[model samples]
Target chain A: MSAQGETPVSRRLSKIKHIVIICSGKGGVGKSSVSVQVALSLYASSPNARVGILDVDLTGPSIPRMLGLDGHPVHQSTDGWVPVYADGGEARLACMSVAFLLKRKDDSVIWRGPKKNAMIRQFLSDVRWGELDYLIIDTPPGTSDEHISLIEHLSPVHSRLSGIVVTTPQAVALLDAMKCVSFTRTVSLPLLGVIENMSGYACPCCGEISNVFSTGGGESMAKRGSIPFLGTLPIDTELVTLLDAAAETEQEDDKPIEDVEHEGFRLLRRYKATSSAKLFGPIVENILSRLSGFTAQ
Target chain B: MIAIQQPLDVPANAPDHCPGTESDLAGKVDACEGCPNQDTCASGQAKSAAQDPTMIPMINERLAGVKRKILVLSGKGGVGKSTFTSQLGWALAADEDVQTGIMDIDICGPSIPTILGISNESIHSSSSGWSPIYVQPNLSAISIGFLLPSQASAVIWRGPKKNGIISQFLRDVDWGDLDWMLVDTPPGTSDEHLSVVRYLKDTVGVDGAVLITTPQEVALQDVRKEIDFCRKVGIPILGLVENMSGFVCPGCKTESQIFKPSTGGAKRLAEEVGIELLGTVPLDPRIGKSADYGVSFLDEYPDSPASQAYLDIIDRLRGILGDK
Candidate 1:
């Protein structure tokens, strides 16, 4: 209660608006990409807004890569955390992860729970996140130490959290998403909505929409739970390509050559221009409708 | 010396003030003595009493009213420890003779308050100390999760903090005497586990540690390490639960191992470690579904196979403890 370990630093950093967390039951559910798109959408919609993303997936942090922010140096200031700029200072976003701490890029995070919790608290306290529109968090799949600690650290402000449960269309994915959703309720956190990613796959050659993982599960879950159903996303090869290219071009101005296979570059460019309308419009609308008076953008 | 225990309701104005820093409150007992309610508020007295080593008056005063202290532990994560703990706690609480209290030492993964459907309970600290939220009529529970502000809030504490919390949970929460106190520890043999073992070893001997593991080779491999840790620490290994041993198809009632159905892991390890194999929990999707809704399968589907497994485990545990 004295906030001994938390210190005055965490006190200063606690003031922020709408901390939205992106979660998945299992890996490969595009949890990171969905988090990136949501943050980007929030950022683009409000130029004055400050949006930061914390990658809690120590071993597999993909936010920097998907946001095209790989290999960018993040330096700390006395006031708060300052994310190294990407695209030649075009965007200033605060990003921190165990991935950022490793001496080399490929080194694994071989830490236990207490150590993991310390780093998470450090990220919350030390980082000068500044007042922001949304602090998008990317959690590791399944309920692990990092995920549990993230919730514990944020519990004092559970009312402010809008948890977004992400999952693929598969039954196993839904099962995991339900566990994540239950975890939210267990911790007494508010249920924002559920996003079913990879709902359907559109084959590039055939231009047909096929239910690869079994569509409509996430929406049904949302309906059953009486929470908002934040629309579903189809499997687009172009989107995957856009993400890959974005990862490569995020930190630097590395332009992809025409001859090279970089679908991420082309798709993400188009995706960006109409992101508000295409990627996040329905989801945002659903969230706003459920929340009533609370609208981010 | 078995005595019937009555439920003690927490007073409306029982000490609602959160204990300040441990150092600040260390010598402030005389200041709190002026309050009308000193019995519960005087945990500082209980802490001093605990230092007596042989004076189990602290344990007797605290747990004399509580029936069983069922400690649930896991060798590692993803072994269905929380799920099993939730189910077992509900089953015991459902019995009239058995009042239940779950102390989740999985400070990092305190999922019980949500799993048992009490995540919204406001944890108020009274002049008496911290008040635990009641999940059932005779069942009360407490965890850092319940103490947290949100499900996403992380408890970042070191050794001293962890030790203080374990002691606070044991002494502060008003777990009125009656039935059982199920403790869900974080997976692995680490600081939290050591803290619990050390506390119980010094005070009341840990009744027993329920070791849960999945049938997977990876999970079983971790179980061996846990067994060795228990031996090193002199903590009693009660029994083994093979969770997700096989998934029972809801449609046909046919059981199959979704993650490798073989019981080689539990059987071989239990034999090697010389612990009883309690039972195998089927890979029932309903258990996972119930867990997601914060409902235990035992509460939702008492007649289900998963529920039965939990009941059998509890019965076996009762036999072990009662015999001793």
Candidate 2:
């Protein structure tokens, strides 16, 4: 094994106690939504606990829009690049994404592997994530350049790093999701467990849970693979409204979601009222329990 | 400050902190000492440099049998790229005389096999090249899923491995005499995108790309980037299709915007970008069910409005590519 010495990346990431990679081999399975909700849940669990979300889904970054931190930009400090906070500046949750550096938010990244790798390295080495209790890295949906870059940079922090695999409930999703589990196994990244996001649809009007995508496929995959199946997160339209309310209430009478001040509390507060948020509570507890096993040397 | 180039292409085996393959000092740099792709990089296989001009004619000759190819792309995932490819395969192959194929280049998530009802089929490569799994008498398909030892096994490959397979899929796959081929890509303009576009664009011309998006602004935002990617690469835009436009309750018969288009959705985006709005398919739960079952959604739900919309769009696409 390569010596796990203090490399530049590990030196920077050392302050972050727990590093969780939220990933899947499949796309459109609500990885971003899960990452945001998990961050919100962590912050809500302990408002003072510092959390950071590094959105490495470079070509298709959705974290800013989901968090309603659309117009915020990263600033260069003397020490390093300062991340934008999801809440206010003093808030515990910080975020760094390629989306923050875009000249125009909607411009196509159009970069290939080497460029993406350099950016990922810079993100790991340059972001000044001061003393985070937890830092969740949301990844793109492939096993290519970005994933490789992340694995290389985070290797030294292996003991502190694990992965939370997200998947929808359909067989096609499960088939692809199994590969993600396999990748984690190959890389020897500790498993935090699997999350079955988009498991079902929570109909707002009817107040019933429908198996729109399906249910329990994640559990079966987990059982077969012998990894922990954290839990199922239904398709909550209410939460969708919160994440995308910028568009929903864009032209309406009320102030748009992103424009409102005290942004973090409002969004996190409303997110707490969501069914997904309610379910994520136990999931976080499971994560916390698993992390507690690691001695903080 | 590290430079991020336009359409940068680097092999997966390149060493860490390696100057990009497109760099003038590519393989000559210190990092290249033991890299596997060092010699290739030094020889200028780097795409943007376009040093080896023979690559185009070679790929063109390899793909000469393919008449017209279309790529189904969305910068966002789970928006039904594979599902659309399956339906398009079935629709195009409806005429038995027409030889149609769907190339699943999503690599890590090759959902086409499962969606096309061939999840159990493994590929067979011969001296001629790899033989595609026949989905129908006329419709054939290829995917890394088929090449996997098991459907659940992960490829876990980086850019170089992906690029190599994509090159083989285009140059070596024996897709004999395909009339219409639909290339399904994963969400992003990364390795697979650059490789496929370069191979096809430099060779036989691509028909264009059919962009997919949901009604929400978040999804549409990515579609704009996908369009930009296409424009930058010089791939023509066929049109845009708004999927999951709305959901109709089986009981109330009322339409609801499940993924509401806050800023007019794809319709507004099409108008703003001066691209045609091919069609919009409302959210039908059965579409997911059909894809999960590995059956043709258009065939199973022919009477449904979504099916009708799909047929209409297929007709329009054929019309656009008909003269060729």
TM-scores, each model vs. reference: 0.51, 0.88
Local accuracy of candidate 2 as per-residue lDDT tens digits, A128-158:
9989999999999977778877887787887
TM-score for model 1?
A: 0.51
C-alpha lDDT values of all predictions? 0.64, 0.82
The sequence of per-residue lDDT tens digits that candidate 1 reaches over residues A107-182 is 3344456787788887877777767667889876666566667766765555567778887765445655666776
Q: In angstroms, how far off is B66's CA in candidate 1? A: 3.6
TM-score of 2: 0.88
Report the lDDT tens digits of candidate 2 across residue range B1-324: 011122234443356778866578887889888987688678766533333466567567778988889999999998888888898899888888899989999998999888988989987878787899998889999998887767766676667657767876887678889888899999988889998998887779888999999877678878989998999999999999988888776655667666778778898999999999999988888888898888999889889999999989888898887742
- Candidate 1 lDDT tens digits, B240-289: 99986764444455554434523366878788668999988776656756
Task: Identify the runs in model 1 with alpha carbons over 4 angstroms from their true place.
Answer: A1-297, B1-60, B125-129, B261-263, B294-296
User: What alpha-carbon RMSD in Å does predicted model 2 have with respect to the real structure?
Assistant: 6.3
DockQ of each: 0.04, 0.36
On DockQ, the candidate that comes out on top is 2
Chain B TM-score of candidate 1 stands at 0.80
